[model samples]
Target: MELSQKRFVTIICTYIRAVNGVYGGAAHDAHVWSLSNERQYMPSNYQNGDKSSWLIGDSGYPLEPWLLAPYRNAEENSLESLHNEKFTKAKSIIERVFGILKSRFRLQYAPKKVVKILNVCCALHNICLIYNVEAPTVIEINEERSNLALPNVDQNEFSRIAQTIRDRIKISLRS
Candidate 1:
């Protein structure tokens, strides 16, 4: 029997920062570990081309596209629209990460032993990835989603802003 290739897995916990709330004893502390990733990535950031870790988001925090406009490349048309869409899509990773974190590891609710449990679960998540180990969990998942509401971004306004961002990015990229 031939052995298959072994793959390594990294446990990533995504969380959002509570800008005005107290979490784990620090105000606006990087409360959500890998959780904050929702607002982190943009679509254009991932080209499936370069190993661009600068924008790869293994760093601290991803800047908002509006503010990150200055760093965009100029040669591409419709870049602003593309980048905005990319950012929105990138945020989805955070959601999926969180969903798995909560459903699989039972990380929901603020428990007194949160950090402790998280450490153990994160380790397990990583381990299972490498061994192709099956994470057999007893918790039965419900079919209904609770929070599926949409954001309040007006489509017309968003298009206008997106266009402006593209223009600005072009100017910045050219300079």
Candidate 2:
């Protein structure tokens, strides 16, 4: 079911690290991401090429040095498939954070200034985490239902490096 006309993008790592992109629902995820301030300034923050600071993204996102997307059409029992499995598992945390946000805030009821409201909600959520306050409820997300099979983007030099990084991680997972 479509949530709303407004599309909100969030980056969560135990806490909501970034909340951005209050675009219309029709906006492509990758397009919104490309225009995000966080994406624009990410290089400066991680100029050292820290392999450990990568972000996990869905197929709708473009693969980049700092962002890892799952392999398209990965064969069963292959290293890519194993990587996808682990990637999905790691990505699920963000999904749960969304579930908690929606359940607690009932974002659907916000009539206007939804972006500001969303930012406030994220801040409050983080504060709750800091104080060890329990969320009143959390919506259970169905991982399979949310999966999108987007076409692979044309590989650029940076994406090629990301592919190598992903391959190294995939191989390491097998050991």
Candidate 3:
């Protein structure tokens, strides 16, 4: 199978929050996110009435009240552009963590128990963080294309709410 066909999805904060490896590479990121147990529980666990917490997702994922995505086709030097810039910067941490995980442990050569292996690696990665272990140097590679299409603006009420929340954040970043 091609490397793209073996894609897995992971959520990371200071450490891995969730990892889903059941989907094949052809699965769209939004589809995976929509069905994830983590996503189901996010409203209860993280989001309350305050709207103080949210997960940052890439363009492949849909915008939701509990999740935020960068504004697509944002104009140059605009507030939306500024938000995307800051969003990219903040999102780099997850990429760096993945780099460290891959560099420290070779996942490509692992056996068929890939999902278990991924979970174990994530756990170990967190342990390294807790103990202050030095991370391996990350070798940057060209990012793979996502299977999902970029999200289009939805006219539904739920989507409008999400867009409003995103707009609030974009405006806040102006200060």
Candidate 4:
């Protein structure tokens, strides 16, 4: 019997800063472990009892009051499924942003070049989006390359709060 190749995974999280109530800058991904352990990127409203504000994340992230994820085992035509649909639509915006970034910058494929060139590319990317500039046609990058397994994280107080909020969203979607 032959052994198959073993693969390693790295998690990337994007940080978007708000200025004048408008989102600015291109998205940047931090390694998952760092995001799991750090608090610097957390928004002020997250800790100030602002229940209305939340982020849409995938199953890779733990449920938190400020982060909504799709429900496990959501059945077809159910409220959970509907919630997941809306959540996915919101998530697709991020996906499209990355697709545009990679399509415009060839250097993005090289890991060492990413940090040095990413900021500039992201700034240009935002500019393109603002002016509705058409991106040059290029070979499509594989979007599923980073489809890694979810990281292991213990459920905590924030996760419970996030789940509670997800439930509320589902209920609202039902009616």
Local distance difference test scores for all models:
0.36, 0.69, 0.69, 0.51
The residue pairs in collision within model 2 are none
TM-score, candidate 1, is 0.40
TM-score per candidate: 0.40, 0.83, 0.83, 0.67
Give stretches of model 4 more than 4 Å off.
1-39, 136-155
Ranking by TM-score: 3, 2, 4, 1
lDDT score for residue 170 of model 2: 95
lDDT of 3: 0.69
Residues 4-72, model 2: lDDT tens digits: 111555453668776664763446566666777767766565676555677777776666768888888
Worst 10-residue lDDT window, candidate 3: 1-10
Q: Residue by residue across 128-172, what tens digits does model 4's lDDT show?
A: 767889876764433332233433324466766667788887899
Question: Over 4 Å off in model 1, which ranges?
Answer: 1-26, 29-51, 55-78, 133-175
Per-residue lDDT tens digits for candidate 3, residues 1-175, read 0011125655546677677777744466677777888777766764456466677777776676777777888999999999989887777766666667778886775344666687888788889999999988764433443445655557555456778988988889767
Residue 101 in candidate 4 has what lDDT?
A: 56
Which ranges in model 3 have alpha carbons more than 4 Å from their true place?
Answer: 1-6, 45-50, 145-154
